[model samples]
Target: MKELIEVLVERKQKNASPLPYHGWVGPCTQVSLLYDGFRLGDASNYDSVKSFAQLMWPDGHPRFCKSMHTMATQIEELNKLIWLMIIDSYGLGEKWESVMINYKMLVQFMKYMAPPPGVYERGLFAHTDKPVSTIICDDQVLGLEVEVKDGQWIKLSLSPSSFCFVVGDPLRAWSNGRLKAVNHRIMMSGDNGRYSIAAFVIPIEGTIIKAPKELIDEQHPQLYKDFDFMEFFLFAFSDPAKHIDSGEQLHAFASLSPPISN
Candidate 1:
């Protein structure tokens, strides 16, 4: 982990050019480089690798690409373990196994430039991830914050060896809203830049997200209707104004018809 962080930080210093693919999204102080496992073995991966190699490392440093690929594979394995835990805890192994096949993973490397002295900036705005789950390996710079149930934002102090696991909209909906999708953001402060890597586990395109029958009872009625995971993802990103920090976008996209009786 430390080696990967060092490599990314060194690359960032040596290359100030815009990122390939989704170049410089969100705040100007933040930039992201993404590697999607789903694109592997396809024409898209070939083109993406060519573009990334040319734009980021003109000299074609194979070590940088190797490091990223290695990290993505590690994170993919970790996500599988976490997913098994979730399935066992919720007893949705059978139902989930059928629909959740061919799950895709995305690894994102984020760099947040330090804000001006004594000023705090929103490097990435507050929002909930649209995937099933996300695992974040944050550096020691300490700018990640999460909103608690009481509406208080708590800054996380994580060590270099630590990893933060966060629930996302699809998982929350799959468990019949029993699992809460956390609202989180990167608050940039101080003079030191922040670096982090996030691995997101997403369902395959057109996977119908629905709660298993075992999780629904009189006490916990069906909260979300069956909806396409990719469709909801597109809906959430299509409109910036509709982006609510509390995961209301999921409700808006997949709430049950006529509402559930209280």
Candidate 2:
């Protein structure tokens, strides 16, 4: 991880950009490595498999390109295992294999350096993960915070080696209101830098996301409408700076609900 951080800092120093949203060389400079999903229509989509470093510094491989790719793959596999376990624990039965068959995933290696004092107070804004689940390695940072339903903020003190598993917007929708996507943010500590890796496990585009029949009943009526994953994907990225209220925003696609009695 230290090596990867060094590589990113070097790249930023050499090829930094003024655009705040560019993932590789801007304000929130992070590298995202995508894995199998609908976007890669076929195995022959060679261009899609190129490393991030290769994309930015196409002339040659960055120092830790291989290491970063290897680390991303490892995290991707781990995410798959954790996803399977969550499904099994819910007793989704034979529905498991067919449910999220088209899901896509990517690992984000983020470097949120300590900004010059008073320049930037927050690193990442408050937002929910769009993936089904997110696993984070905070790297002993003390800046991660979660906002519960009551609007109270809870600070997470992570151990260097500990992992934080977070439920994302997709899972909340998939579980039919049984789960809530956590709203989280990253604040600048103003002392030292922070390096954290996050794996976002998302569903494939065009896949219909909704609650399973088993989880929907008279008492537990469907809380959300079934919608295309691709549509949701577009909505999610429509505004990179927008902070979404997961449930409220998703309600835009809500199916007709039972009318209240007069």
Candidate 3:
């Protein structure tokens, strides 16, 4: 918490683009107190798409033991390392393991607005191509959109210190369609636009992650099949531009991709 807060303060001082955020696994899910978020998913085709920054990873279950909470709260790296294990390592996490993750919700939001998965999967981007979503915000700000084509891009607004997650297509591949990576983009907002930072936890290389015994008790045996995190990360991060708007994809890539600025 100390290190995370320090970084946030520094970004504010710099008036950094989109501002910066520090992410880790904690007792409660992080959310914004002010800004609203969006999700977009439209893969059927349409060269590109976008949305707000978000990410997700299962914490398994919240800690009831005070001692465990104390340890996690004190050690920031533990929070980061655990997440790395999941994404980069492909989830070596067993019971009591917390995962660090990040992603932009814009893609999921766009997917929500666009036709369903089946619609786009059928040769869509080739026909009636679209530049981006029609967007409007409470206040226009810089750093809202990461980059632009033609004239502009789609940007999103979110409050400081708050974070969310998006499901990625790579996950869908790894999850065998159980989870889907979102396709989204920015709409070029002016205010509430900011930079973000996340420290995703990961395990060592060559560890093939699978569902733990706890999440899948006798009644529920292995809902999701197992796979290698390293391979999944490669598939997910290979073309970030393909899914930059998705917090889900970003969260999935946390274990694989390096920090954007530092």
Candidate 4:
């Protein structure tokens, strides 16, 4: 992982194009992976054709490419299992099985070093993972923080082998507000540097993301209108102004119908 971080930093130093993040946070480098677990899936063909690893790592980095492929593949598998469990918990297991869940995984490597004394801390601003979910694997340093009730930011303590999960917009809408898509931020400490690889789990672009019929009853009214995953994804990256904070864009899709009478 350290070697991968070195490559990312070195490439960024060379002015490689950073992922356009709608001006939300500072610069970072990422490589999107292929394979939606189906041959000719066409779910990630556009990205896979680009070969992000080859583009970023370039020559003399066979190990880097190999590692990226291995990690992305493993994470994709994990993504499916986790999604299955999540939907099943909401009693949508049988319905979910009939629909294929697609995801585009990215190997994001960020390097955060302590800023000079007395300067305003420079780190990623508070935001939510816009996809289905994010599986974060951080090195020793703990710079990640989650927003709890009352808007308090809580620091995380992660072990070397532990991975943290952050829920995302799609699931929150799909679950009719039953699930929580946490608001989180990164704060680099004055004495340590941090690096992490996060797999941003996205869903099938064409899938309509609305609360399942079975999950929505008189007691559990639909909170959000039906929306396509790709549309929401594009909206998020298209304009930071629209979504300046967590739940802003999502709230835009709120359903206004009166609750169903029991």
Candidate 5:
């Protein structure tokens, strides 16, 4: 994360503009500059597939906060934890993700009444940060605009960077019969202001990633297997929605279902 901040800092020092908000449905092939600790897309498993965050705008990555980026030598603390993630990812074979969503959105919103930034892609999904926490907002909905998959759409009266985490379904599947992926998202605030930063952490592969053994009883044994990161990445990228369902299609690594022989 420190490295990410540094990259941002360097750019911001030159009076760079904040990176545009890349909506959830981003170009699957595009890459961004604001990189948290986790690798982006999983195209392959044997070798860690290098993927980057989708570019927010043409010149910048995301909302760049000059004040935050200019803070004390904060890079040291960030480097340490990243080391662990690197170790687990490379040495331990633990499939995982870790990220920090800055609060630039809410900050800028308070200044102007223009259209707000779109939700981050995969930003508000089905995964929760460990250590258990919640994000509350003061951006009350003064007026209703539209309806989405599960909730209402309204402008939030908040700052620019009110970042949060949403536990995704993919992690749940990877956890075997252990961890439960949580469904989540962000709502537009209208009356008040919100300020927050969300950091998401996940594990690496080669290890049989699964839910806590306690979650599974005798009635429900382990449902997932120790999968290759590349194998799983391929399945996920091709069809994120389909990868979550249970059946032969869900676990078809190397064409193992009907046509391909194991």
Candidate 6:
């Protein structure tokens, strides 16, 4: 991981050309490089792995490519295991394979530049992920923050080897709101740049996301209706107001109407 980050940073320093954007059904693959103040590069699907690697390192870095491929395989396996545990907990063990059939993993490499002297900048805005789950592996920089249920933000100080697993909107809906998606942001400060790799478990283009019957009962009512994952993903990016808060995005896109009482 350290070697990969070093190579990427070196490449970014040497190259000043603008990165090309690639369009997909959703926002995950929209921009290969997202440059506002910081840099964020994404490689999704199998074909994109090599393509993005070549784009970043034009001359080709064999070791970097190999490391990314290996890390992606490991993350993919971990995603499967995590979903298995989640489904079993919700009594949907038998549906695990079917549920995962339309899902794929996306790997993102992010580099947050150091803030200006005596000023802290928001590297990334606070928003919930649109995927099922995301696993983040960060360097020894303390900038990642998560908002808890009490409306307080907690900054995460993580070791280079530690991984943070975060739930996303899709997982929250699939579990009938049993699991709450995390709202997170990156706040950059200090003199050193922060680098992190994230593996996101995202659904394919037309996957219909809905909570299973086992997860919805009278005590636990269905919070979301059956909705196309891609549709909601696109809506989240297109709607101006929804872009501000992901909770609002989910509510606007797929929340079910409550039944009227006597």
Which candidate number maximizes TM-score? 6
Instruction: In angstroms, give how far residue 219 of model 3 lies from its true place.
Output: 4.8
Clashing pairs in 4: none
Better of 1 and 3 by TM-score: 1
Better of 2 and 6 by TM-score: 6
Model 1 residue 114 CA deviation (Å) reads 0.8
lDDT of each: 0.66, 0.61, 0.30, 0.62, 0.30, 0.68
Give lDDT tens digits, candidate 1, residues 1-262: 3333334433434323232222223334222221111112111233443445444454755665566666667777887788777777877666656534356665666667776789777777678878778888877888889999998999999987889999999888888888999999878775777777777776666788887777777788889988888788877766552545447889878888653533
Q: Write the per-residue lDDT of candidate 3 for residues 99-172, one digit (tens) a residue.
A: 32222112211111122333321111111001111122222222323323453434445564334333333333
Residue-by-residue lDDT tens digits, candidate 2, 176-204 = 77777788888775577777777666565
Judge candidate 3 against the unseen true structure and give its global Cα lDDT, from 0 to 1. Answer: 0.30
Q: Which 10-residue window of candidate 6 scores lowest in summed lDDT?
A: 20-29
Better by TM-score, candidate 4 or 3: 4
Tell me the deviation in Å of residue 136 in model 1.
0.7
Worst 10 residues of 2 by lDDT: 34-43
After superposition, candidate 6 runs with Cα above 4 Å error:
1-47, 240-244, 259-262
**What is the per-residue lDDT of model 5 for residues 1-262, given as tens digits with 9 covering 90 to 100?**
3333334433323322222221122112222211121211211121111112223224433333232232211322343344345335433425233322111111111111212354222212222222112222223322212224465444334444332233333344433423344333333323332222322222343433334443344565556554543354445445553455322333443222222111
Q: Which candidate has the highest lDDT of all?
A: 6
- Each model's TM-score? 0.78, 0.75, 0.30, 0.78, 0.33, 0.80
Q: lDDT of model 6 at residue 76?
A: 81
The best-first sequence of candidates by lDDT reads 6, 1, 4, 2, 5, 3
How far is each candidate from the true structure, as Cα RMSD in Å?
5.8, 6.4, 18.0, 6.3, 12.5, 5.5
Winner of 3 and 5 under TM-score: 5
lDDT of model number 4: 0.62
What residue runs in model 2 are displaced by over 4 Å at the alpha carbon?
1-25, 28-50, 116-120, 239-247, 259-262
